[model samples]
Target: MPATLLIPLYRDEVAPRFDLAGEALLVHLDADGAELSRSSVLLAHASSEELCRIALEEKVRVVICNGIDDEFWQYLRWKRIEVIDNVMGPVDEAIARFRADALRPGDILFHRSDA
Candidate 1:
């Protein structure tokens, strides 16, 4: 069966904090990891509880975000939802890394230029 993934968004990048995220990107992937569909979810407000509820309601198999509180992290883990936290980058880059199985906790995918 295909799997579903969620990534909280802040503009075009991953949200810096999961609890404060007001939008999310939902992606569906097939067994071989090819993207099946993608969509954006706009939340009425920023709330960890609401995000978690959405994850559950959508049957999300994985969540990728920048920072997440231990409470919510543990809750998702307890519910068997895989979380790849501490990821910082453009949503497209993060999704590509995830699809390639290269995304990991604490990954910083942003490019830095020396001034």
Candidate 2:
């Protein structure tokens, strides 16, 4: 199965992006460790809302990121997609941790917006 990881891109480990919607999502195929960067990234020229649309259209299964708005959290949860928040450390390490099942439904996460 595939996982959707929503990561808030920051110069360092702290702080949110200038735009609340201006976040990057790294999608990875759990089994093979293959990343879907080129085919999935929709922030090159589109608005954040558009990118969110793309994620839903692409059937994003998981979202791993630093932080997300309460609205998007509810939307994703309503769609039954898994989400991970407050992610730090290297992206590779995060992925590995997820695979090891060390991460829980709300381990690195908070309210699902729906809650």
Candidate 3:
């Protein structure tokens, strides 16, 4: 079986706040964790309600994002959507981690600068 995942995007990285995300990436993966399809969805506006509606409409199984409100989180959970919140990094790295079943809440995938 295949499953769908959603990631709120800010340029090439994961959006810092779910309620403020203006775009999202939808990915479909096979039972073996191989990607079946990926597409970007541009929101009409940045709104948690809108995002929630989109998630339901798209039948998203998972969501990767940061700074989600507890109300929204609980709602998604109640609706059976798996949310991995507080992630910070490039979208590609996050997706790779997810595909490998290593992505978790509060993960920071960005490299630190020594400077």
Candidate achieving higher lDDT, 1 or 2 = 1
Report the lDDT tens digits of candidate 1 across residue range 1-115.
5789999999999999999999999999999999999999999999899899999999999999999999999999999999999999999999999999999999989997962
TM-score for each model: 0.96, 0.61, 0.96
Taking all chains together, the TM-score of candidate 1 against the true structure is 0.96
Candidate 2: list runs displaced more than 4 Å.
2-8, 11-25, 30-42, 45-48, 105-115
* True lDDT of residue 38, candidate 2: 24
Q: Give me the displacement of residue 10 in model 1, in angstroms.
A: 0.3
Model 2: clashing residue pairs? Answer: 4-62, 4-63, 5-64, 6-63, 6-64, 6-65, 7-65
Candidate 2: residue 67 lDDT (0-100): 56
How many angstroms is residue 26 displaced in model 1 relative to the true structure, after the best TM-score fit?
0.4
Model 3 agreement with the true structure over 1-115: per-residue lDDT tens digits:
6789999999999999999999999999999999999999999889899889989999999999988999999999999999999999999999999999999999999989972
| Clash count, candidate 2 | 7
Ranking by lDDT: 1, 3, 2
Candidate lDDT (C-alpha), each? 0.95, 0.54, 0.94
Supply candidate 1's per-residue lDDT for 48: 92
